[model samples]
Target: MKKQDVSKCALLLSLFLAASSSQLVHAEEPVSDTASNLATNVAEKLPSADMNSESSDINVTTNQLDATLAPKAEAITTETSEKASSEASQSDTMAQTPVEGQSLNLRILSTTDLHTNLVNYDYYQDMPSQKLGLAKTAVLIDEARKENSNVVLVDNGDILQGTPVIMAGKYGDHLGLIDLEITFQNGKWSVNKDKSHAQIRKIDTKSELADASIVEIAKEAHDGTVAYVRKQVGTTSAPITSYFALVKDDPSIQIVNNAQRWYAAKELAGTAEANLPLLSAAVPFKAGTRNDPSAYTDIPVGPIAIKNVADLYLYDNVTAILKVNGADLKEWLEMAAGQFNTINPSNKEAQNLVNTEFRTYNFDVIDGVTYEFDVTQANKYDKDGNLVNPNSSRVRNLKYMGKEVTADQEFIVVTNNYRASGNFPGVKNATVNRLLKLENRQAIIDYIVSEKTINPSADNNWYFADTINGLDLRFLSADKAKDLIANSKDIAYVGPSATAGFSDFTFTYMKPDQMTSMTSTGMSQADRQAIHQLAAKVYKETRSSGQMQASLPKTGQKQSTGLAILGMTLVGLVALFKKPRKQN
Candidate 1:
């Protein structure tokens, strides 16, 4: 072959190979679309010389190229077409197959702040309310579930307390403390033994000695560890009154046994809230109520009924959880510290322990963190969370797990929706993790039912710091302090005050460490000595009332002291867990 003819053959071969590669790259198209176009392109590009010239050599080379590449092009086209078809089939199968880890859709249902309205009925107005009750919410929950096959339910708290309906029935009769009139017979003082008779019915002095003295008789009555003598029921013309032994657990006997103080203790509400997410809680309370001294709930500890739950949590606030830093936690405590009045450490005259102007509900005690308020220093914030005294700080030794809480250390705090949104200092701007659908009261009830027997004991996590040095701190409480002061190491009965139905109690604030040992199960030497003096004083007062007698009552004939049981009940509260949901 000639050199020029050889170069033309090589160029034709290279062009055919390039066109085939391009056609295969877009092989999804029909074979007829490009296969004929490749042949026509090579023929057009050849020089058009007449019969026996150099162009005839090019034409011969093109004919030779077509012969050499035809079979190869046909094979490439067939292979490309089959591969495309197979890929299309595979894609169709893939589209129809179920994914192993596909996401799903889920719906969350919630209700909160039921506030003792378990049913639709309202006791105060004596009518059924459509807007009330957790039962009513069940229908809505069902509808929500139907909309989404995957669903979850949650509650935010504040279900137990509030609503006069909860207070109008049997639970309304809070038999706080029972005063049993015991007489010394055969050198042994005795009172009623049966707890049922001891609580509702009056002490039958006529009956034989069940146990020695009021304390021993009270200890034998296992129905409740405490007894309270409710001074007077609100506005009842014929209110029952009695003198009952104020046992340690008896809320009515103490001068200050209200929901605010009771739930603030670490054992009851604190433990319940903490246990939900296994985190700390910052529970708040007011210093006073609309009813003041008359507004008190004292439920017995024996059998927990529906009415008892109402006495514990006194609100309709929904539960909430906030993620806050330790510094913010401290600020929240500062706002709560406004509950107390700044005391002059050097003053000898008695001063009020609490600020009467501060609302009780605003006072928050953060459980799981050990802290104290130095009442001697002015409060850093007012009840409304406004910075009152910028230079002053009352919260001292704020700690978590025995270590000082760092400014940026994060913590999850359980609280009600009211406090979370109320713009309280440190808590107002907190990052809310969840706003639950559950009521606070219902949470308490659920917790009670699960535990069966609850011991609402104070862990003494917080207290006033060193108020006993030369400061004659005093606070007003129920007149029942006369019976309870003997056992208390921090409180001294200071006689009846001018305020009707109230008494003056000297607040002998002890060091936190001293408090544990002094108020322990076993009495201290000082406690023993104080008890002896207090016993004589209580005996003389009893004798003066003409209630105590040396002679025993006629055998088997029970005597009524005109003391009726006061209505009291408690409810548990707070905390809910998150349910896993499908993403859809």
Candidate 2:
């Protein structure tokens, strides 16, 4: 063979190999319809080169290349094209909704202030059977998404710590404080000024106050940044700030996740404005409403009548911790701190307790008239904030910037069920007719119980707005407090007749805490000792207001006085203290 012929054959062989390899590379690649069509047109116009004159040496190479590369390219193109088409079909199906002509039936399912209820696991009940775990709630959420076209799940904040999950270490070591990321919707940005505004003072913006808050802010932000970075690279970082951190940007998950959020978040498909509907809790047992706690469709807002609330319980979540108008956030936090100390001072996380949201008990002004609750009898001071008597019933004052308020005025008073059972100061005699409940307390738990997953939110804004300030401390449940009656053994107690008189009297009952309570001021230790002494003093002198032995033999069976008795005859009656105990 000629050297030139061999070289030409080698060159042709190289060109053929290169062309075949290029085709193989594009086998599974997505082809643009326009480019493919143009290529087809150009291929038809190009003159075909015949290989009839090729030497026998090139025949083997051509056959080998065709067998190895041609089939693979055809297979890949068909497979890639099919997968893309299937995905498009699935997307279309998901877009379709049950309601025709309706846009996405976007029911934003939000669980506000769900502090770490990972187990649905009610620690109070102290049983695993009563599990209110988010694991179970996720089931309901899954079913909800099935029913609706677009279901956006949201958590309204306070997600850091609450339940036994705090002790349930992440990876069995560090606190399960997850550090989640923010995913804001388009054209909207969040300015997290929670730390900066917590210390805001309105009267003087230029006050030379020590800027200790800036240092606190830097520390928190720095920690948050580190957490996010560690999570991004899948490093095992300690003390994740919240539960949201665990599942954020998880490539393993094809859905969004945000468990530590407090504010209302809105997500719009296009440039349309988004308005999330506010939640108004409908209660079954409000004052002036037949005193029933099992009625349905009670609280209504606009056209939406809230029904099916039989199993859904109401908590004074809104007004229990902080009021919106009466005071600053600091006041509410302080009050919450008080409540925590009162409830469980020795609690390990007492400093960070979030039992309830504090509410404001603001007064109203109607037609130039201020509506104030009568706290005169409730006040324990002698006009100078001086303690006149320990047992005085101190009412919470209602004033508009230091000015006294009058009745018939309007105000948005914040409170929770523990106080709004119509048994707080100033409003002690008031019914619970003037309060509005926030979201149903049990709905979020239900979601967690039925659905094991949380619908992730895209917003970074969060706040619970504690409302615990200005409200009197309630030592008992609403029923016990409202039904307070004077105990003869209770020096702080007012007689039942006083209550019946509707005068300054209030119903008193034994609180579960065993501490005596009164509509009056709390009793001093000396005063309480005196009351027990008085009970002993009034024993024999206390002629039964009903019937007594005008002239009887001293057959003293041991009485409440614990005196030495002789027989079970006509003696000083023990006022029938033992309420007819059954002879077992």
Candidate 3:
């Protein structure tokens, strides 16, 4: 062969090989619509160029290039296919065995402030009110339980002190509390005789009553009184009143007087004492040990049982799992501390150490953390849980699990929905990981029944700091809290409150010696009397005499007319008896 012909063949061979390799690369890759069209055009032109070539040498060079590259192209295609299959098989294996590391699935449920709505029925309206109740929440809890095996339920307190059921249980038959001797006279409810001084009926458990007719009557009266109060207040959220008149006719007024007398008697005798048994029954979960079992000592081996006389709390609040940073947690503690008022030591007047306006439901005594409130400083937040003063810091020495919590550190807060709501200051922005929509009361009940026991010992994670050496702080609570206050630490029973329903107590911050000088300075005798008089005036004004008269028995109408005629005759006799000298 000629040298130039050989060189031409070599160049043709290089061009053919390069074109074939480019086509193979394009075929291997996943092409888009545009790339596929470009590849098709190149494929069509390459075959035409081979057909148009008249040189036999060029055709021979192309044949040699094709033979040499065919095996290499086949090997490349096979390798690409095997690689894809291997990746698909690996992805399938990963889908089958997904277990990675040791991890736990935990759920926490919580409910709060249920107010004794065990059933979804409203006793006051005499109908069903599905808006609030444990019965409806129970269904949500059941659904959650099926999904998770590990679950913990907790209530955030305030389960007691609401609803007609609690009132009925506390006061027994409401009619029995009224002193008048009631009788059905002339087809109407009427007072037959004065029974004001008599203890007409002792308030006891409903179970003890043989004839419950009085209770039924009392329920009706209570419902009527509540409705009347609601109407007068112009809202359905009126606070419950202990005393109100059923009617205002001569006989009905006498009945009201008798009811007041009964109320006074009960107050003097301390009716709250009667409520202890019922309260205990409603909240029966005990946390601490009953009797210590010591094998070495003479003490009997008592069965391990939950028996602590702590205040019975209903389990209506569910448990909640929250992810909170240290800064937010500190902010929450400060908001909780807003419940207490900074005592003014310079002022001699008996000042309330705690803000009476702060609702007890908003007070959160968080467990599993040690913290204190320095009441000397003002709260960072206000009554509405809004940040008002950022400079003030009330929360002091906040620690979780014996370590100081850093701002960046994250911790779990087990709380209820009320606190978790946007209205609750620091908790508003918290990340809620889990919510078990369970009634706290039922959760506690179930825990007791399932665990067969509980240890009701205080975790001692929360307390008020005695930073001020001799600061005199005072708070008013139920009169029945005298004994509890006497036994408690850092607190002393100062004296009885001038207010009828509550008692006053002085709190000593690390200075028990100064407690002697901390006299109970609450509402003064004069102040109390003035308040009572004002309350009486308001009550009389709100409760119209005409409304009471309209409710009076129909049988009393004739008697009332007779009394009016007798008054007119007495006036005439007085006028006739008067001498004519008075005119001169």
TM-score against truth, every candidate: 0.44, 0.20, 0.37
Query: What order do candidates take by lDDT, descending?
Result: 1, 3, 2
In candidate 1, which residue ranges exceed 4 Å CA deviation?
1-288, 518-584
- List candidate 2 segments past 4 Å from native: 1-103, 129-131, 157-374, 377-584
> Against the unseen true structure, what C-alpha lDDT does each candidate score?
0.40, 0.22, 0.35
Let me know the TM-score candidate 3 reaches against the reference structure.
0.37
Count of clashing residue pairs in every prediction? 47, 73, 17
Better of 2 and 3 by lDDT: 3
lDDT of 3 at 48: 22
* Residues 34-83 of candidate 1: C-alpha lDDT, one tens digit per residue: 11122123223432211111100001011112221111111111123234
Which candidate number has the best lDDT? Answer: 1
Candidate 3, residues 1-584, lDDT tens digits: the string is: 22222223223222332222111000011111221122122223321211211111111111122111111111011123234334333322222211222222223333332243444433333354443344444444444456443333323211112211001111111110111122222332222232211111111222222223334545665456444322210111111111110000011112112222222221222223211110000111111111100100010122211111001232234444456777877887777676666645565545455554454345555543556677667778876787888899988777654568788766555454545555566676666445433333333322233223222222233445566547555655444445544444565676654433345566656432232223212222233223323323333333323321212111112223433443354335434443333110
Worst 10 residues of 1 by lDDT: 22-31
Off by over 4 Å in 3: 1-315, 345-350, 450-455, 485-489, 511-584
lDDT of 3 at 543: 34
Deviation of model 3 at 12, angstroms: 99
For model 2, what is the C-alpha lDDT against the true structure?
Answer: 0.22
Give the CA lDDT, 0 to 100, for residue 516 in model 2: 18
